[model samples]
Target: MKLHTIVGVALAVLVATAGVAAATPGANAQDSNSDDAAKQGPPSELPDPVPEFVSSIHDAVSDFLDGALDGSLGDAVNDVTGSSQSPPTSADR
Candidate 1:
């Protein structure tokens, strides 16, 4: 009885897998047709905004860090050293 049950279960799984495999090609063909249609449309200059937004945020953070290091940190160091020298400007570089 156990052997019969195992054979039945295996046969059912085989049938299910074969059915899925047979159906997959048709589904993929339909998808490819739709993809081809989409490809025929006008190309985008920029399809994704993620990299642009990321670079903008990166620039903002870098500018903030530069200001903190060059402006505030330099003044603090100068105060500790008791030096009358001003923080170096970009033009000084």
Candidate 2:
């Protein structure tokens, strides 16, 4: 009878400890930060990369062609248009 009482008391204590542990909050329990994030709404989506990549490539090619044409034809165009605005050189002085 004494042995049975001791076993019963041990089992009761074990069950109580388990109940307390189950009732306590864990690391991932909801808190203020989660509530704030919920109120802020869904996160913004990232832009598509294909259009951005194509735009960058188009800009690069356009800039390269403009530079090439300007270097090759700019002086000729200026001379023909009589709008050559060259700065004074040592020979001019």
Candidate 3:
């Protein structure tokens, strides 16, 4: 199959390049970089937007469950009972 051929080629390439690698680092320069990085603290960057987006989605779902779906369920119950399909107001709570 095509997948088998692709995997076979990948393995062959890996074997061919197995010995090609960076030389081991010396003692002086490597320690200096690490020491500087430690002094610098965490990297400065824009906040990740993923959490905010996830929070918005969570809020939306909460709103739907707390209000929209609740009202719809009340309407459905009213319909079955041959009552007015109007949504429940706060005073009805």
Using TM-score as the measure, which candidate wins? 2
Going through the candidates in order, what is the number of backbone clashes in each? 0, 0, 0
Local distance difference test values of all predictions, in order: 0.68, 0.65, 0.61
Candidate 3 per-residue C-alpha lDDT over 1-93 given as tens digits, one digit per residue, 9 for 90 to 100: 699999999998887666453344545544645767577656678676674445544554566677744445555445445566587689989
Could you tell me the lDDT of residue 71 within candidate 3?
A: 41
Model 1, position 19, has a per-residue lDDT of 95
Order the candidates by lDDT, highest first: 1, 2, 3
lDDT of 1 at 85: 97
- Residue 50 local lDDT, model 1: 64
Ranking 2 against 3 by TM-score, winner: 2
TM-score of 2: 0.33
| Candidate 3 lowest-lDDT run of ten | 19-28
Question: What does the lDDT read for residue 33 in candidate 3?
Answer: 56
The candidate that wins on lDDT is 1
TM-scores for every predicted model: 0.28, 0.33, 0.23
lDDT of 2 by residue, 1-93 (tens): 699999999999999999999999999776766766576656599765674445544554565577744443434444444556764557988
